[model samples]
Target chain A: MSGKEALLEVDGLKKHFKVNQGWIASLMESFGSGEPDYVHAVDGVSFELREGETLGLAGESGCGKTTTGMSLVKLHEPTAGDIIYDDQRLSEATDAEIKKFRQNAQMIFQDPFESLNPRMTVYDTVAEPLRIHDIPNETARVQRALEFAELLPAEHYFDQYPHELSGGQRQRVAIARALVLDPDFIVADEPVSMLDVSLRAGVLSLLDRMTDEFGLSVVYISHDLSLLRHMCDRLAIMYMGKIVEKGPTDQIIENPQHPYTQALINAVPVPDPGVGRDRVELQGEVGDVIDIPTGCRFKNRCSEYIGDVCDQVVPPLEQKTEFEQDVACHLYESAAGYDPYEEMSGSPSAAETGDGAESTPADD
Target chain B: MSQLEVEDLEVYYETEEGPAQAVDGVSFELEEGENLGIVGESGCGKTTLAKAIIGILPDAGYINNGSINFKGDDLTEMSGPERRRLKWEEISMIAQSAMNSLDPVYTIREQIVEAIETHRPGTGRVESDEIVTEMFELVGLDPERADDYPHQFSGGMRQRAMIAMALALEPSLMLADEPTTALDVIMQDQILKRMGSIQEEINSSMLVITHDVSVVAETCDRVIVMYAGKIAEEGPVEEIFNRPYHPYTIGLKRAFPNIRKSSQDLLSIAGYPPELVDPPQGCRFAARCPMATDKCREEEPEAHYENGLRSYCHYADEIDTELRPYADDSDTWSQTAAATDGGVEE
Candidate 1:
């Protein structure tokens, strides 16, 4: 997976939203030397999407998966960091370069119901992208894209409005619109989450075909591990505006290093009833991105909280295992010798469970 | 006798076009302390069936023909006040959308106390507060935060509060409509785990309606697969997961990608469900069933029983030999369009 050329590179990407303080509150805050509040949605996140690779961006809601995807597509402009596509820096790109980048990369939104215009016909929706790019041969391109989406004949659906199509068909129209530009990559944010289970497979298979046949790099964002496992070649797990762990799909799912990743995987309800997974009880819900603590954001809910170290130092994502994945946690000290974490002990729950690794903590 | 016996349940919604047959000729029994899950896609009438049982269907919707016998008393036959009296005390529902269900103005404790006091007016504030605390504890919410408004709590917390409210009076039968649909995987798991423990403690029968089959696979004891507002199959959860006799059940099972397995090809049931207002005069699943024949398109299948598993399909008895061979293949399902076209009279 690493051998392929990088299609899109996101480095230290940060997107923050200002919490609106009323005039009275703003005046009160101005009187004091207090910092203005900002929801640190996507903070210090970095990842690379190789050509022809399908990378799954997975996290619970508000964990910045959607924010990161939006940032990549310039839907949400980043406050910090950089997004480079096809060797051109997006932030510093010329108008022409940016326009070309837009044609190169597209986004398939989560909800098909709201994504497409109700008034626009299927042909018009698919043709809009081509018209915007000022690409010629609009008639042939739109029909071909629809055919590629398996909307069968494409002409049959030319006049049908979004309201006329089913959830699956509407999504296919969304897909055709995304693929009409013939982009190098597309960011699909929970593309099938709204569709029925029966229809999800069809849409997903179309995405699979896009990557395999067209060699299109895709950043597939979803909360479902099951769907991600089937679709993604590599998986990146996010928590509270940062990539906690990212590795090969199988490696991450089978042997997750981060406590948050473990809990997330264990929590997924397996379809097979016979295989009973012991519940990993983490204390609280996801912490607020606003006024985030100095150290690990996940420490409050992390079962494997290893004392003050987790609360004191922000962990950097690095190669924790022999595998290609990188994990961000205080437990896996990147230094060769003199582990500071070895001295401090974990909480009672961590010691009792002690399934994370052999080197976590031992009773003397 | 069973705790809740629903017989020949036929529910319809008065639409602009005509009466939409949301639930048609569905019958099932929920025994004491049994966890029955109704799994299907949107428009399958699982939610409508739940709403009907709980007697909270929308204004347009009504029970066309059915008998909802709860505790030897038919719920459909009861008057407005009589049914209202029975709600929180005996039967409760955990609505699909937790946020919408909880009133934003009232505090969690106040809302719960109101339900308790309304059902049993003699209960004092202190007693009701104690019940609220106990219920909150059972649902894993901090009892101290009971005074907080619905907006003060997170999505998961609000859902827990909803669960706490539903279990406040300790209803004999609990109806949870997609309890964890809006929640994330971790929150969903925690909520489900909490519900399971609470059910064990209270010994209540729960009817869980969800579009996700995996939720049913874990939480439910018996499962009913609904298609086009009709029962396509009914059996134990394990049997439904392992050996689904109905073609719809088979297709539905294959649709879900298992977390345990790697790179499994997900096969979708091609084509949309028939229009509910005027569904075809045959098996509702015939259009999408790969094993569907001309006989299937002409007539509705009778329920075939095999070791407690009841399947509504022509080849239910010979499912293993005939349908199983072609079920897993995506191509088999894709060809269903052509097969159905051949059967359709133009």
Candidate 2:
């Protein structure tokens, strides 16, 4: 419930890593190879982040949630599409404009141990950002950031390395570094997942405070749904390099539209033993991003597989509920004329058993 | 006699400063065909306990004093070879990291067959092959991939292969130490479900050690909540989740957000767990616990029993009246911890 102004507008964002490389690929290219392969890590994902609104990217491992977050912060240059941030196109921005954007946006990595340099002291880690941005009063700024991160008596930690600090303290240092520049937004990828449960809440609450105090828009990328539900205002479920569902956090959690989203929600183990949840056992693992399915990426594992429509036509993400929820499933139609579901009783064995058999339709 | 009984187990890891009392004076019993979970945070010694039971402690670690009685046989008293003989035949372990646990050089089939042949000498190759195939099918893995090396398999598949190997012998006791920690949530759920069915099929008791409370709640019939290398609470899963008596348990339960409940504040237990090396003489959790007092810091607490529940706390009797209410509030812990700090200063 923040301002209507879109702080970041991402349209058709795509990042593909070349699978065919090295001497072999060069030789093939010399002979005029037919086509090179690519792993579609973040393929055609689009979302708008309203100012000060926290958006969560939820999915299993290799679902491109991390890739999407990395792409947004320009950690991975996009192969296609546009990233409009604060009315400035990042892909086409000049050197000065790009530097300004870099100062305004920050990213907190998943592993505090790996992300923070072991050799760098806590003081230098926080001050390095300010120094890079050419901001003055580095010591004072770093001190304020550390204090804001709840590392009291900041001067005491200036000399200490990451190894000297506990997992919680290391994460606090990372948060301090991320917020040292006082960025407009932060892309925190599994920030607290590495910390202990006791320490997790402290770091999370600190994040909550940052958002409230600074009105910082945060993009939280995590597989833990419960954590996301607690921290995020909106939820986007990614499956096979695409957003399968996007909606308000509560609405998506309570009433998931996409079958993949439903499976993900059901799979999260509830802490309360009394609530006996009916387990939605989705068959098969997440599809390979390299050889993505032609139509619905989730058709291989979806328990509610309809028919040939899922095998031939890719489902467009559209408004399928009364609330502001968009789901990419043939089960929900954007128009009234065509019904995607012809039969639901037959087993999806044809879809399951065959790989790259796009020619054979399950049903017309 | 129980299927397995650990009495006064004390495992210490040698460090430069002193011996870290990783698992100090811990005792628990597992009945035949029962699922028992040991839940705690990192460095609380849950992993150490599991490692000690399996007789796979590192060279630096040793059992100071304890008895591990399996089927009325003392494993702790047994020699290294004697304990090695019991491995895979009596008590098998599913280690935390599948990638690390699985042998990368050998094929999956070869490794499993080697395990079978080692434990059951004179076992024919054809029979071992059948066993590997059956185990693979049982764990929802393709039998054709048996020849594939561990490096070729995905994380989930590798874990399943581990389960297949662990259950190949059909050991009476199965010790899974954080089996699903490295996998995705959906993959974790699938693996847990598969483990459940396989356990039922084989009729083996499982000892799941994990820091995830929700995973424990789902898979365990009974749970032991460990803190600073001691059991803070032990009871039926329902009792632990619904009505915990120990302040640490209450704090732990509150730390995890209930997916079913709409937006609620998560209360992190203030302060870290006490240093295991030369730990304080009083209650180990007194510093972080909300109901901690001067007595808690001065004297150790004995086990207080209520029905089938066992809580290690000074104010266990007055949990409902005193501890439970304050444990949920974030401010209560901070205030109590601050007051305790002041008292320490005084």
Place model 2 in a CAPRI quality band: medium
lDDT of 1 by residue, A74-143 (tens): 8887887899887778999999998898898899998999999999999999999899989999999998
Model 2, span B165-284: residue lDDT tens: 999999999999999999988889989999999899989999999999999999999999999999999999999988888888887888897777778888876677888898998899
Could you tell me every candidate's TM-score relative to the true structure? Answer: 0.94, 0.94
Question: In terms of docking quality, how is candidate 1 classified?
Answer: medium
| B76-127 per-residue lDDT for model 1 (tens digits) | 9999999999887899999878889999999998999999999998999999
Candidate 1 clashes between residue pairs 3 or more apart in a chain or in different chains: none
Model 1's alpha-carbon lDDT is 0.88
- Local lDDT at A27 for model 2: 89
Q: How many backbone clashes does every candidate have?
A: 0, 0
Q: Interface RMSD in Å per candidate, to 1 decimal?
A: 3.0, 3.2
Q: In order, what DockQ does each candidate have?
A: 0.62, 0.56
Residue B139 displacement in candidate 1 (angstroms): 0.8
Off by more than 4 A, model 1: A1-3, A27-33, A321-323, A335-364, B337-346
**Residue runs of model 2 more than 4 Å from their true location after superposition:** A20-22, A321-323, A335-364, B336-346
Q: Give candidate 2's total backbone clashes.
A: 0
